[model samples]
Target chain A: MIEVNDLTKYYGQKRAISNVSFKVKKGEILGMLGPNAAGKTTAMRILTCYMPPTAGSATVGGYDIFDQSMQVRRITGYLPENPPLYTELTVKDYLMFVAKIKGVEKDKTKAEIDTVIEKASIGEVRNRVIGKLSKGFKQRVGLAQCLLNNPQVVILDEPTVGLDPKQIIEIRELIKNLKGDHTVILSSHILPEVEQTCERVVIISEGEVVAEDTPENLTARMKGGERVLLELEGDEKQVKEVFRTFPDVTAVKVNKTAGGLLKVEVESKKDLRKDYAQALIVKKIGLLEMQSDKVTLEDIFLHLTTKEEAA
Target chain B: MRKTLAIFEKEFKSFFYSPLAYVIIAIFTLITGYLFYNLLSWFVEQSFMMTMQAQQYRQAPPKFNVNLHLIRGYFGTLAFISLFILPTITMRLFAEEKKQGTLELLYTTPITELQVVTGKYLAGLALYIVLLIPTMFFMALLFIYGDPEFLPVLSGYIGLILLGSTFIALGLFISTLTENQIIAAIGGFALSLLLWIIGWGATFTGGTLKPVLEYLSILVHFEDFAQGVIDSTHVAYYLIFTIFGLYLSLKSIESVKWRT
Candidate 1:
C-alpha cells in the first residue's frame, strides 16, 4: 500500500539517501536491512509524513506524501528508532493522548487505548510513569501508541533493539501476526530477526538498495547452487589430499573437532554427497557425519553489503 | 478542531504534572508581588508629602490618588517585565520536545502544524493566567485601603493578560526555531525586549517619523489600556500581535517538516 519513487534526502551537502525507490504491497511484511547511516530511518520518516523528501515523491494508501499528508498520516502509524515517548506521562495517559491526536473519536478513544494496551501486552504497567518503566515496557508503550489508531500501515524502526530475548520473541510474533491486517515495514540490523518476521527483505547500504528478495530467494541467490558440511576421521594431511581428489568439491575448509574428528565445510558445483561419501569410504577415512550447510540470511546480508562496499 | 482541543487539554494538564510550571508561576508571582508592594508604598508616601506641602504653602495640591495610579503603573511595569518572564514559561514548549524526539510522533499524526502551535500557545497562556492570579489580591488591598476605580483596575489587568499572551506567542515561535531550550529562551527574551524598547526610540525621532515609530511601539499602544482607557486600537494591536506571532510559529513548525 506504499509506493516510493526516486526518493532522495540530503542533509546540507551530504546525501543521506540517493535515488532510492521501492514498493510495499498490501498485507506484506517488508523488512529494510541496513547498517547505521544507511538511510533506513530517513526513508521511513518520509513515508510516514513526518518529514518530506528532498527529491521525488512517495504515496501511501494512494495519497502523495507531500501534497496529501493528512490523508497519508491518517492511514499510517510510525514508531521511530528511539520510540518517541514523553517520560513524564504515564503509559495510559500517553496512549490516550496519542489516540486523541491520531483523531480517534472521543467516544472510542478509551476502548482503542485498551485494545492497544492489550495488543502490546502492557496492561499491567499502564498506570506507571513511562520514564520509570523498563526498556522492554517502554518499547511496548511506543508500539502501543502506534497501534492506537489502527492505521493501515505500521512502520517500526528497530522495534526490538533493546528488548530481552523473551521480549524479542514476543514482539516478533506480534509483528508477524500484524502482517495481513496491517502492512508492516520494519528496519533492523539484525538479519535473522528480519528473516523470521518479514516476507520480503530489502538490503540497503551506502544510500542505495543493494539487494531485494524473499529470505529464501536471497539466500539461494548468494549460494549459487549447493554447499555441504562434512566430518571425517583422518590425519589433517590425508583429509586435504582426499578432498583435493574428490571431483566437484569447489572449496574445502577443515576444522579439528574434539577427539581429533576433522570437521570440513565443503562447497560443490552440485549435490555430490553420495560420491564424496564413497570417496571417503574407499580411502579408509571414516566419515562420521555429513550435512548441507544452507546459506543463511546473515550470510546474504554480510555478503551483499560487503560486496557493495568493495565495488 | 476536536483534535486541536485534545492537544490543548493535554498540554495544559501537563504543566501541572511537572514542577517547571509551578516553579515559574511561584517565582513570577513572588517577584511581581514584592514589586507591587514596594511601588504602592512609594506612591502612597509621595502622595502624603504632596498633600502636606499643599497645606504648608496654602495652595491647591495635585489630585494624587495612590491606588488609581498604582494600578496603572502596575500594568505598565508588567508589560516591560513580562518580556523576560514569559519567555522562560514558553521557551521549552516546542524546543524541548524536538530535542527529546517527541515531536516526531506529534508530527506523524493527522493534525496540522497550525493546530499544534495553537495548542501549545493556549497551554502557555493558561499557565500565564494562573501565574497572574496571586497579583489579584494586591488589587483587593487597593480597594480596601484606598479609593480604587474598579473599571480602570480591571482594564489594566486585561491589558496585562493580553500583553502576556502576546509574549507567550512570540516565545513559542522562537522555541520552535531551535532544539536548544536555552537558545530559544534567549532568543525570545531578546526579541520581546527589543519590542519593549522600541518605545524609547520613538522619542529620539522628530516630525512625521515620530508618529510612525510610536505606532510600531508596543508600549505606545499598551499604555492606553494600562491607564484603563480600553482603546480599541490597543486591543486590536495586542490581538494582531498574538496572531502574527502564532502565524510565525506555525510557519516555523511547517518548515521543519518541509525542510526535513
Candidate 2:
C-alpha cells in the first residue's frame, strides 16, 4: 500500500536519508530494520506526510505524499518516535481528539475510540491522565491513537523500544495481529522482534537499504558455509590435523578446554559429519559431542549492517 | 472547515483544563477592577473640586463629559493592561505543541496549515473575548450612576477586540518560532510594546516620516475607536493588520514542515 522511490531528505546540508527506496504490499507487515540514525524515522515521516522528501517521491494508498498529502494523511496513521501525545490529556480524550482530526464520523467517534482502546489494551487507564501513566500504558495510548479511523496504513517507529520484556512481547503480538488487515511499516533496531513479527524486512544501514528479504531468506543467504563444533577427548594437535586433512574442510581449529577436553570448530564446503565420524573411528578417538551451528537472525543483521561500515 | 472546528474545540477546551487560564483571568479581573475603581474615584474627586470652586465664586462649574473622563479613561487603562495580559493568553498556542511534539500529530492530519493557524487564532480570540466579559458589568455600573454615550462604549469594545486579535495573531506567529513558552511570551510582549509605542516616534520627526510611524502604531488607530468615531479606515487598518499577522503565522508554520 506504500511505494517509495529515491527518497532523500536533507536537514540543511546534512543528509538524514539518501536515495532510499522500498515498498509495502497491501496488508503486509513490513519491518524497517536499522540502527539508530539509520534514517528510519526520516523515511517514515516522509511517508506519513509529516515532511516532504527533499529529492524523491512517495505514494501512500495511491495518493502522492507531496501533492495529495491530505488524502494520504487521511488513510495513514503515524505514531512518531516519541508518540506525539499531550501529557495533560487523558487517554480517552487524546484518542477522541485524534479520531476527530482523522475525520471519523461524529456518530461513530466514540465507538472507534473504544475499539482502539480495547485493541491496545489500555481500557483500565482510559480515564487517567497520560502524564501520570507508566511508559507502557503511554505507549499503548500512542498505538491506540494510530488505530483510530481504522486507518489503512499504520507507520510506527520503534514501538517497543523502551518497554519491559513482557510489554515488548505484548506489543509485538499486537502488531502481529494487525497483519492481513492493515499495512504496517514498523521500524526497529531489534532483529529478533522483526524476525518474529514481520513477513518481510528492509534492512537499512547509514541511510541506505543494504538488504531486503524475508527473515528466513536473509539468514539463508548469509549462512554461506556449514560450520560445526565438536568436543573430543584427544590430543588437540591430532584433532586439528585429522579435521584439516579432509579435502572438504576449508578451515579447522582445535583448543584444549578445561577437564582435558579438546574443543574443535570446523568450517567446510559441505556437511562433514560423516567424514569426521569415520576419521574419529579410524583414529580410535572418543567423540563426546557434535553439533552444527545454525546461523541466526542476529548474525544476519550484523553481517548486513556492519559490512557496509567496514567497506 | 470541520477539521478547523475540531482543532478549535480541542484548543479552547485545553485552556479551561489548565490552571493557567483561570489564573490569567482572575489576575486580569483584579487588575482591571482596581484600575477602574481608581479612575472613577479620581473623576469624582475632580468633579467635587469644581463644584466647591463654583460655590465660592457664586457661578456655575464648567460641564464635564462623563464618557470622556470615566468610560474612555477606563478603556485606556484596559488597553495598557492588555499589553501584559494578551501575551499570557497566546504564549502557549503553538509553542506548547512544538515542545510536546504534538505538532507531529497536527501536521499529519488531513488539515492544511491555514486551517490549523486559523483554528488556533480563533481560539485565542475567543478566550480574549471571554476575558472581556466581566468588564461589561463594570460598564453597566457607569450607565446606572452616570450618563455615558453608548456609541463610544460600544466602539471601545470593538477596538479592544480588534486590538486583542492583532496581538494574538502576532503572538501566534512568534510562538511558532520557538519551543519555549517563556521566550514566546517575552517575544510577544516586546513586539506588542514596540507596536504600542511606535507613535512616539512621530513626535521626534516631521512630515512624511511622522505619518509613516504614526500609521504603524496600534495605539493611533485605537484612539479613533475610543472616541466614538467609526472610521472605516481604522477598521480596515486593524483588519489588514490581523490578516498580515495571520499570514506570517501561516508562512512560519509551513516553513517548519520544510525546515524540520
DockQ, in order, for the candidates?
A: 0.67, 0.69
Give the lowest summed-lDDT range of ten residues in model 1 chain B.
B64-73
* Candidate 1 lDDT tens digits, B1-260: 88778778888877777898888888888888889988988998998898899999999987976545688888876666677788988888999899889999988989888888888899899888888888888888888888878887788888888888888888999999999989999999988887787778878889988887777677887877766788888888889989999999988888887673
TM-score of each: 0.93, 0.95
| i-RMS, each model, one decimal | 1.4, 1.3
Model 2 agreement with the true structure over A263-297: per-residue lDDT tens digits:
88899988889899999979988899999998888
Which digits, one per residue and each the tens of the lDDT, describe model 2 over residues B188-211? 999999999999999999989999
Report every candidate's CA lDDT: 0.87, 0.91
Q: Candidate 1 — which pairs collide?
A: none
Q: What is the DockQ of candidate 2?
A: 0.69
Off by over 4 Å in 2: A230-234, A254-263, A273-291
Q: How many residue pairs clash in each candidate?
A: 0, 0
Q: Quote the lDDT for B146 in model 1.
A: 80
- The parts of candidate 1 lying over 4 Å away from their true place are A230-233, A254-263, A274-278, A286-291, B47-63, B207-209
Q: Write the per-residue lDDT of candidate 1 for residues A1-311, one digit (tens) a residue.
A: 88989999988888889888889999999999998889999999889988888898889989999999999999998999998998888998899889888899889988999999999999999999999999999999999988888999999999999899999999999999898999999999998899999999989998899888899899878887578888889888888888788677788889998888998888888888888888789889999899987889988888888998899
Taking candidate 1, what TM-score does its chain B reach relative to the real chain B?
Answer: 0.92
With candidate 1 superimposed using the best TM-score fit, by how many Å does residue B235's alpha carbon deviate from the native? 2.3
